[model samples]
Target: MGKLGLVKARHLVSRTGMGAEWATIQRYKNLTMNDAVAHTLSYVDYTLPRPPRTSSWTKTVGNRKSVSRQRNMMRMSKNEGAALQTWWANHMLTTKTPFLERMTLFWSNHFPSTIAGTKQPSALYHQNVMLRKNALGNYGNMLMAVSKDPAMLIYLDGYSNIKDDPNENFAREVLELFTMGGTVYYSENDIKNAARAFTGWSIDDRTGKFINRPEQHDTGVKTFMGKRGNFNGDDILKILLQHPRTAETIAEKMWKEFINTSRPNPGYTRKWAHIFRTSNYDIKTLLTAVLTSDVFWHPANMGGLIKSPVELAIGTMRTLPYRLRKNNLAHNLSLMGQSLFAQPSVKGWDGGESWISTQSLMRRSGLMTNLTRGNLRGKHDPLFMRHMPECSDEELMAWLIPVKPLHPLPTQPGRQRLVRALVLDPAYQVS
Candidate 1:
């Protein structure tokens, strides 16, 4: 009920948004907890810069049909995909509503479609837009839209699905990964039937839009989850939405995303799932419940999550006056293991402890070191230092690091020196 002071404000911003930005934390520190949460959910910026030019689906398809041009097509796709990654990274670095972009990134992993898998950056660009449009709106709606998304259709082999020879890739992942969390709730037969139901959902070759070919559709009765009916792709999605586990799956993911990387408590997840399902899968409603829950604000949970590459790199840049020496942030992120458009697998990046492997830890530490190298020297830029918040040493430590510095602070008294020490400390690795 009281105002969320500096510590609490940082937790909310770092967990929900891209980073615990200084100005944002200062703004939130004065507001009541409820007001702060409301403000975070409400603020969103929809404007996007012009996307990088990529080959149209029609052109790409034409090229793919020719054996000699196939290699050229692959090269083109790789080049365009890298540009797409950079474009998105730039947006995340500068977005006014980092929370909106953060949620968009979350959903992207939940329903992944890779540049390599699709070979269509244009379609992936559209898919990213669709994800952001519904990021905070409705889970059920997003599910329906993404299921037919052209990038997903190609990535999951859904576009190749026809009545005569049904491709089960999309159905299998939808049941196992997207909705149910695993094979525990649905049967193999359910997946086969669900695949049959989704048969005719394909992409328009000329326009690259979702197009249902009724002639290719299987109009037979299918039993999905013990319910028998003549079904289509929409029907299958509607049935999944009605399943309780669909809501629970998202709730559990939110736990890992916002709380900590440990296994989620079912008691908490089930309660959140009920709220999600009852609200007709309203995303904001579920987010409000999760953000306001006791566990989200618990003292023991502070610094519980390991920072993803985006959080470490983009978050640091946003919070401080530092920038990467090289502008190839997208490539840097790939090296650090969170490439924007190219997830390693359908499971996406296994964040958490996985983000800090021996190789990745070195990269992470090296990044922080490089960003703070200039500041570490006594030759601090007076203009930049003056622009920084005027605060005591203790306050500065709290603002920069989520927890007490794992290593001792510097004996030297310069503000820049202290900041460099806090950032380089092991404790700065977590939120």
Candidate 2:
């Protein structure tokens, strides 16, 4: 494990927690771990200024349909669409906690949902709020909220589930994707039984409320994992949580996300899983333990991972010597397959290797060029050079990059010359 001074620590935190920034990272460099952790957590709730609206539909049942119609109309209007883009731009620029914001962004992709598919932006928005506000909170709470989430209800066909005719989509995903690993922990019968338990649990299309229609609920006894019960959705969840695989599977995913590998050490991951379950699914503790470990700060681990497209774009922009307008910034990201509220599918954007291809590489290189050369409108900052006075050219390269130190400046005159010639290099492209 690397025990870094403040300067290096800032770089590590920013890359791992948020995408990238120089000033805030340097500012936090001198602080103790406690202070630094608190400062990092503070940047989470940079909510955009919501426009005011006097909707009479929220007051009574009669106006509800009109309200929904109005919402749909606004969604279709070009002006409102432009404003939405503007809101995201401003939020990204001015948010207090870039670390938390980026973490929320990371989780959003990890558990992908699309307002375009669900036609429920409010539910998508609700899920965003839930994830952002509680990204580091209890995993159990997040799981439960996601289970009944309005966006999730529609995305996974939870709303279509009926008492006698249960939809297995949500239940299967909850087990196979969300909590447990593959079929190792659950059999086909368990999935079928779990599906029955979730019947009658749905969202109200008009109000976005989670409604449990007991009348439509399946009350049949279920034999799940060799145990019998008149299991409902909650019962299914409870049973899943109780399984050892649930804890281990989640620990594995968490390690992959933060530790930068899908194939993390299972023994070590299981140890962390025990820590997570023992602490009652406190995600923060799990994250802290992982981040502060020797495995995390090792030279081999540094920059060994690929940056997701969103990370590449955002990090490059933030590190640029310019000021990008919010609308344009958000627009640029949208074109690069990472629009804020619009993911492609329920599986979300595949990270790591899948995030790159011939088409995506062009988009990535183009974004870097646009940001660096002041090609973007109203976004040219000359102050970027001053952000890292302490970091020399070689140190700057190391600071911005999460990779092992390349040949130091004095050793490789030709490579140093090349680095000076190119504003963006292959190193910056790595994590």
Candidate 3:
């Protein structure tokens, strides 16, 4: 791969790290594949923003240590959550490497839940944290963690389930969406049976603590995946994780997220599947194999995928020499159908072609104009710098929108005209 190829690779992985800046890419310019893999993994905890303040319901519990009360605290107002979002945008743009942030964003979509409904900003933020923590670890462990996540619990109505009448939402989604992708690894009978297993799974109203009420649970044995047993939600997850289809489903997602190519390379997927299962689902090992694969850096794949709203928003922010605020940044992302911690449904956003449409393209174009013209105020206000204190105009343009200039900009011109022409160009519409 040449310099451009390196830039492409860095951008692709930014889905795992958001989009690493040019300076960060330059640091690893000469690293061998193995060395680069190690270097990247070392960036899991590269840098982070301060924790955001959470919401608290008026019905306050004096005991701050209680999960219910804590959950309430996490569900702060939109204004409060804005601070945290700002922190995130700043960190991602400025971090030496944002691989974990990008990876967390990917998993958030994959496992898709919305904190908006639950009003639990803290739990939502915590779920994001958990995703980052395990984004590149063990799939089984991560799945289990997501299953119990407070944000997920509330988002999927797991908190409303009881022994007498199981909600069935979480149980159905766990098999159909989270692990198996609705391929009949499980059946309706299995869903009913699984719901019984998860009876009494509820959360504290004020505090967001998950509780298992034995009285609400059905202890009767039932069959799942052709196996007969009294299975609970955890048992269902375990069965799915142990199934071959489970491995296949997860491997396919890895292929799309890291590869982002049109069709899946089954040969590549299978090679990684064997490694994933053999290594007990180690994420790092699987990613290492994929990233080091020859096809990942191929020229044919460059700019082949459309940038998700999140990617377009963050990539622009990182490349441009500017800043943004939390609310404005969140607002732009929301307009793009990818607000952090707020997905449309349990299935999450269907990536790839789903992000492209006439309306979406228009919104992206509008955002570009606003960003470059200093008209937009996101998490980091002034997300662009027309007057670089040090670098020349050409260098600033190259730094900010390196993918493909929206237009051929003059070295010096009215910032308004230059930004408008470049942002309106088709290249800015694609990655």
Candidate maximizing TM-score:
1
lDDT score at residue 250, model 2, on the 0-100 scale: 72
Report RMSD (Å) for each prediction in the order shown.
Answer: 1.0, 4.9, 5.5
How many residue pairs clash per model?
A: 0, 6, 29
lDDT of model number 1: 0.91
Sorted by TM-score, highest first, which candidate order results? Answer: 1, 2, 3
lDDT on C-alpha atoms for all candidate structures: 0.91, 0.66, 0.67
Per-residue lDDT of candidate 3, residues 38-59 (tens digit): 7777665634567766654323
Candidate 3 yields a Cα-based lDDT of 0.67
Error at 61, model 3, angstroms: 9.8
How do the predictions measure up, each by TM-score? 0.98, 0.83, 0.82
lDDT of 1 by residue, 1-431 (tens): 78899999989999988877888999999998889999999999999988999999999899878999989889999999999999999999999999999999999999999989988999999999999999999988899999999999999999999999999999999998899989879999999999999999999988999999999999999999979999998999899999999999999999999999899999899999999999999999999999999999997888999999999999988988889755578888998999888899998888889998999999999989988886755535685586578888878878877788879888977778888898899999999
Better of 1 and 2 by lDDT: 1
lDDT of 3 at 323: 46
What is the overall TM-score of model 2 with all chains considered together?
0.83
Off by over 4 Å in 1: 377-380
TM-score of 1: 0.98
